[model samples]
Target: MQAFDLVSKNISQIIPIPIYVGVFVVLLFQVFPRIFIARQRSIGQSTANRPGKDSDTPNGIYDRKPSLSSLVTPDPTFSWRDNPQQIPREIKPGKYFLTMNVRKLDFNDYIIFDKRYLSEYRERQAIISNVGSARIFVAEANDAALDLCEETLMVTVDFLVTRYPSMFHRTERGVLCVDAGEEYDLVTRPWVRHPLETMCLLSGDDCILMRCCNDGVLRVAAVGLVYSLDIDWTSFVGKDLASIHRDARIPFYESAIQKSVDRYFLKLQPDKPVARANWLTQIGPELRNEKFPDEYFRHVSTIPGNTITPETVVDDLYFRVERQAMRKLPSMRGVVFKFHLYATNIWDLELEEGVPRRFAEHIRGLPESVLRQKHCLEYVDCILKVMDLMAERQEKNTTNFHN
Candidate 1:
């Protein structure tokens, strides 16, 4: 035994302790990480493709998939003619008040997944895939916007899973199941993937999630918008409400409007969701890339006396209405502003009995400054001509009735 110990001691002396320790340390660093990474990848693959009990079976605890046929039909109908009765009493045509105009949003109106869902979802997914994290913004947990995103995502998911069970399934494993048997990890942290991304995955609405700052100004911290109209959300990030509306043609930041908006945000309760509508006229129906430089519109004016008629207006212009909703998240105490866009041909306004007249009256009542600010000066004549045609048609109908 002494001889064996003397041989081992001689070998140890030949190879220094520090060299042995360095070799072990190098192997530890190299081998463990590879093993850990391999294990993680394997686990991820299994989780993604793991087969569970069929979601189609009738189960008391699990919800069945929602019927697509029934879900596509929009409720309360989106008619400009019917808008007056639907609008709050305080909101009138000439004077626009955000808070007073808003009404309690029905659960069905909260997140609309219409027939355009598939197309819109595809476009949104493409944008997110192409842009990566550019569309997602995050602030520190201590920041006012911290919990806004996650909470909004949670509520949206819960609402869909509960109400439209056929469309969304909650797995026994606590995973969210959507179409094509796909599963999502809804509980992932913002650093891994913002909750807004998950929301985009679930619906077509363009979400602009905001939170009140220390300075008492609402700042847009996160956005998941694929069809933003004339606005780049990136520029608005971290900006206060007033700053965001500084260049807006509409008088959204007027003293009264600003105060009401502030108060609305402050007093908004989790139980109540408020919705308001904004309408605009655009030259095309393209959903994405609605944003163009102001100079581009200005340059359109330089073209010498471009002739436009009622027929041209009907053929060329589109009417866009954005249904916007503001809901306060109970857990985060932050606001989630969602926008659902709809567009129709300008001539389609005539289909509704009173909508054309109301629209014409509203357009004629706008001040010159506001018209120029909205860049409507160039096409105002065309819109007026179309309005005249509608008026003439209404007058003819009245005359025939009297005869």
Candidate 2:
């Protein structure tokens, strides 16, 4: 034992304690970061492998991106017009108020291509030309707008080609192959400088990219408005959630649901997308006009209980429903708010079973304050009377057919 101790003492003396300390310091500086980085990599891999929780999902953008390889092929025969999405059954009789009513969104259902595609795209181009891209789309100056734009385009084209292989393809470099015509490449166009505009022109859809600010509230980091988009794009740019919702004047959003929604946006996971729907009964089929933004929306502010009677309301009623979906852009650290609006003249759908009666009942159930916020309280009676008439005619037709 003394011999072993003597040998160890000799070795220690030969190395010198200060030299040992120097070598240890070198290793700490050089090796620890790499080890720490490796540990981080391992954690990320494990997190991706397992399901993501709000608390655990890494904020790194590159962790998970939607790619063609990951896409779920849509039903070959799915027709957006014929196969209208089922109106979510979240509204309850006598219990109607503002609600998120969001559901898990399948990637395949992210963008809806309908009979209105060509017309909508034409309208989008006109809007772009008239309003200019700056009016509709905005993004953070320092963030990965380029990457987000490109990645978004890639996923979008992948989805379109996969969903409607006959209409769109990756054969050339475009999203379209509608005819024996030139196929659009699966890439951005050289002529368009603005990435978001290119996305709007190609996809012809409405989407806004939002990121949480330092204050912990989501704000409009980007926009790509081409359709009859929901948000008044110019109004909410750079505005936080509280201010945006307040400006939006959505009933109960500020008081009842702001915190919940703020947390929802803060914690939204990249892999999991959610969806919701909003319905409005308006006096006209024209829900929006891009050239005169928000003009149509505000015109219907007060119908005056006296101005809207059953006779006047029946001819002018239209129902507009916007199917909305929200998903996190992992790469951009943003949440995308997407909407597809479907408007049908109530005169056309009044006969559809349960359409008028259900909507009327839901509207009637709204508290007076809610109705006032909705701009319909003064005219609620007229609206209900028209609804009853439609419901009666529908029931009578059914009874006649049965008899």
* Local distance difference test, each candidate: 0.62, 0.65
lDDT of 1 by residue, 205-257 (tens): 77877776677667777777767643445676776666766756455456547
Name the best candidate (by TM-score).
Answer: 2
User: 195-269, model 2: which lDDT tens digit per residue?
Assistant: 666566656557777765666667776777665544456665677778876875777887788888888877776
Identify the runs in model 2 with alpha carbons over 4 angstroms from their true place.
Answer: 1-62, 65-68, 74-91, 145-147, 171-174, 177-193, 228-232, 290-310
TM-score of each: 0.67, 0.72
Scored against the true structure, residue 124 in model 2 reaches a CA lDDT of: 69
Position 204, candidate 1: lDDT: 65
Segments in model 1 whose C-alpha atoms lie over 4 Å from true places: 1-100, 130-146, 172-182, 188-193, 229-232, 291-314, 394-403
